[model samples]
Target: MTKSTIKVAALSAAIVTALAGCNSDSGSNNVTERPTIAECKTYEPTQPVIVKGDNQDLNFQTITIGATGDMHGRIFAYDYALDDVDVNAGFTKISTLLHEERAQNDNFLMIDLGDTFQGNSAELFNPLPIHPVVETMNHMEYDVWVPGNHEFDFDRDFLFRNLEGFNGAVISSNIIWHENAVDCKNTGQETPFLRGYQIFDYNGAKVAVIGLTPSHVSSWNASNPDNFRNLDFKEEFESLENTVDEVIAQYQPDVVIGALHHGRSETHGVVGVNEIASKMADKFDVIFMGHEHARFIEQIDLGAAFENGMDDITVSGDKANQVEDKAKSGTYNWRNRDSKVKVIEPGNWGWALAKAEIDLFKDQDGNWKIYDTTLSNRTVADVEEDAALQSEMQHVHDKSVEVANEVIGKIVGNFTNTSNGGADEAVLEEQVLNSEGQRLYTTIHSAKVSDMPLTDLINQIQIMYVEEKGSEAIKEQIKVDVSAAALFSDASNLFNGDTYRRKDSANLYMYDNQLVAVNITGENLKAYMEWSYRYFNTYQYGDITVSFDPEVASFNYDIFDGDIEYVVDLSQEAGNRIEITSISGSDFDKTATYVLAINDYRFGSTMLVEGWVTEEDKIWDSSNETIYAIRDMLTEYVGLNDLYRTEFENVNWYIKQYGPSDAKGNVADEDKGEILQLREDGGEGQDLWERLQNKEICVMRSGPGARDSINVSVNVDNNNTWFVNPNASNPYEGCTYSNQPK
Candidate 1:
């Protein structure tokens, strides 16, 4: 059958079943009868209600009313990480607010627009499953509840279980049951589910409340299909339109209110609510919106008649007020008269509460009319805590606190109980000293070097370089080269007095091992220097001069070659190899590869360093072990004569002659004295010893040349990695695995 035919057939079947059930009840005389007028008390409005005399001779006087808004509950379960204490406290607060409202508003009938369960820890562990939240709502005495999208989070069975004990009405106009009445009966008390909308009476006046949830729930629930299987949430406007018509015809009510669990219109715009409101403008009087957490108030009018293909005019603001005044003329004429509708929304998180009061009045003809509607929103503040409520909520709060405390301890150790700076330093020191320290075994992903006194080292290096150049001309050249390296490489040089820190392997404290700077021929050196200048040009630096032969060929990389290569000779032989005088390759590359100087994390291959792929590269352990090695070497070199101590004093002079320059072509001023002092003290230097014991030192040794060209290998077997390959079209080209291993 076609889809339309199937739908018609299903609808026909539903109508037949309903009619049959009604007939059976009528035949058995089982339906409850209504009371006669003589047995009921005369209806009277307990509050003032102003009315405008019009059709039906409706009297103008006091009328009973009900108002409710901002019933935000269980929304927390959807998207929050809270401990048990906070969750339970939240529920308790909701309960307290409900009770407070119940006591204050005599004619008030409480209703929730859904989203009560599923957000947080409380829902995760609620005993008796999905029903605990329902039980709490029951205790709060909800008059009616419309199921929201989250209501289906646990499946229909779980929903039914929790809703079983609820005394209030469960209403939804859009939900359609798959089974018949007979099937429902056969399924027993734990039947899969029930479907239909319900009507309730308030103060002798019949009021119909319809419920509709978002249609998107079908796809959103795909992750947990079993929970929402066999259920469908049709388009809300369509369902509401049909349901409102049927409801008005079956049980004429003075007011029609639609409770929906969809988001409000401020964000989605007036489309969704507008469509429902405009279509049912003549049908339903009010629409209660939920879902999106916002606040707004708007009106929709639908009584305008169509003329020639154009919509009828809608009167608003002063025009509407004038219309009401004109209606008081007692002409029973609706000509030039207009009606107004209001839409309101309140923000979420229990931060505010919305209050709306609708006053109904009877005209001279006894027909009911809306006198005046007042809306007021109040901020929740300085309210006294209900003692009894607090006691109940505290139980949940306490448990949550316990869980939070445990988790905090797990991540923070004893740091939580101590002072900040002092505690941080102490913990760091102890961790370095003890093998059980988290940092010792844990990988060091990055490092930050402080920028204070280090700039002085650059200045001294530059000055010393200029002095060594002899002639003023060569001195100028040396100054430029020294300035270039210092300016480009010195992250701290810019913005005078600014402190800098870097989280990388190339730092002074991390360089406890010996370093040997290889010398190149003047011609090749100029080329290398030019390349260095080019690389440094991309970075910023402080006052520093730098110059190089712009035309020379630096490294044997074809990628950087351009027209500039012809400006300088390329035949100059340059020594570009690093030789470790303190430790030979054999010393480190033993059968099992003995321990060598390197940072603790790199030794463990934490940052995924190249050449340290095998476990054997974890030779020297962390900086602590390397420091001990330095101490041992220094002690042996010093002997009883302390001859090495004198050599330490001259270390500064040696660095002044060969080290990278400062702005003045000398070794950095700040580091000059320290280098000498460290040399003199040897292993006995307090700073050196402290750094060693704290494992704050890093030791690294360089290799001959860029053999692999790649720094990091994506495929260990294929030897494919990233490197600054000058031969490639893209000099900084990254290599990928290509089946062959180099």
Candidate 2:
């Protein structure tokens, strides 16, 4: 028998022993019980068995492939930032389910769809030759690995080191060497940085797996060109098509799989995995997707339906359906596209594993052809973590925990209280740190919506860093006039007392974003503010609650400080939300230029994409300094000044039309008293304001807030016909805005 056959036979025999362990209820023995992998009691296949051919021959084998994506470095069932045990998901938990699946299948192969080694506690191990994420994968014996966009978040050398440390075959067909790189020895522009695909021969049956990373890595990481200094990530579709054709021609594989590190839904105008799988249904048998952090199994129809179907469908002629038309139809199912392809994503953070079982049979022509395929996500919610793996990774976990608990500085006050004109103090939800009465207070509502000390602290730090430690050229040219920052986490907070740990700082500023100072035109600055305000949905009549647009990411919304004053009009649509009153306390100028402080991510994803600026816009970047991470800078700043004080007053920007407006939904100066009274009154007014703050009510009006008697609409029991007068003593006369139990 061949080596593949021998391995299959051994794995097949192990199934009996695995089943015995799973079915064991023996209670006679009193010996010490070792840590064991959990049986898959909740492992019910979600998708039905898909069969393509009929063959009842002995020359058939079932190959099981397991996958995980966008892990974001959750190797252990613990949150290092939170400094608590997170029993939800981890590689240790996933290992249990993986072991169970491997024992059941005759042949097994494991793959991680990339985005490992970057989030939370994962970066703590970056200095090591083998990162904890790669170490865990190596321990699991992963067969193939792909690179995600975040893999390029660090320096080139760190990424290369981890990739080299992995035992698995690293692959990304789209990544190639840049021609002008000094380090380009044998790898010129045409040479791929890693293997494009890996062919696995199982008993002479070849299975080809092609890997593709996000094509927008260059744009995403443009802030630090050195991160991907010698690499070029080609477009996904062309690269995938070329690689698939080459793999088929060279290997003549019986089965083809796509290990793609792209989301299912299109983002930033990039083609999503769903669309790619649909367009290439005839070429690939299975495709695993990542980066969206979702778990699902979906299939698409082939040939006629695949080409002619609407909404993410590809067509050939004049009668073809348009994607825009389908979008306008308002019934397009983006989750499950109408095409001939099998796509699966196993979520993120080691919560679930993507599994694809392919049953191959020797056809009449003496060639191996796939007969049956099944795709599903195996969740590890009910499974116990692999004790052996957890033990091995114990040192890393302990170090992370130690780092998390280490006191970085002393913070005596809160960082989320409002100062300009709203709530005097943020409603604090006290969290007990330990039995010693140490505490941290988390804000009940998102500080991103309004001016708060937390975000102001970030903006202040950026301006301070650039002015004091900026390049000599930047100091000579101009000082930072404005700075913008986003509250990455809603739970961001400082200690209520005098003790602040490293975790507290991490909770406030999570990512490893570097500080950047850029020269921006007044026109572009206003436009940038408008784009950031797109996070809020336009206010409507009877909208008792303020809401955000689902399409816009919350992190993209930034708060401006340092010599700028603006008002965000929620009543106005995007591109028209920001009403800048002044710059440096003077009249706003649209033609003038000013220095703006921001993170590198904003410089790439926003400023560059919007055509507001280019690489030449940058005056200074922290990547050239001693510390690059914004989180680390904040920590250092906090350490230098032990007392946590609001360095800058939260008066730069505030929101308009986020509360109860006048009868016509207008913000009349005369109605200010009534509005505040209504919000303060313990009756309908207070109810309205609280509901709006809590996001429990949405009141929609018929027209602009200028009418004296505007019609307000509120949804009541699936009905949107409820109308009322906003100026009336009981503006909610006909509208029951509250959906809560009375």
Count of steric clashes across candidates, in order: 56, 13
Task: Please give, for residues 419-495, the per-residue lDDT of candidate 1 as tens digits.
Answer: 22111211222112111100121111110111112222322232332233222332332211111112111111111
lDDT tens readout by residue for model 2, 1-742: 0111112123324433332322211111121332221121111111111222243355878888889898888988777777876555688888888789878964787889988877775776565555667878877777778889999999878887667566557788888776555555554237667768888777667778889999888887788998887678888889998999998888788788899998766656677776677678778887888877654566555443433222322111211111112222222121222335677777678757788778777777778777667666666655689998887777767767776786766775555553321221222243222111111111124365556566788888888888877855355645888999987765466644647777876777878788889999999999998888877667654443344554465578788998887777777778888888888768999999889999988898779888888888888888777666777777677667764554544466667644323222234455343224355557765665564433243244221111101123221222353222232343222222221121
Find the candidate with the highest TM-score and give its number. Answer: 2
Off by over 4 Å in 2: 1-58, 183-189, 267-269, 302-339, 418-444, 471-478, 659-742
Task: Summing lDDT over every window of 10 consecutive residues in candidate 1, give the lowest-scoring window.
Answer: 441-450
lDDT (0-100) at residue 472 of candidate 2? Answer: 57
- How much is the lDDT of residue 347 in candidate 1? 35
Q: State the C-alpha lDDT per candidate.
A: 0.34, 0.65
Q: What's the lDDT of the predicted structure labeled candidate 1?
A: 0.34
Which one is best on lDDT? 2
Off by over 4 Å in 1: 1-101, 178-196, 265-271, 303-338, 408-742
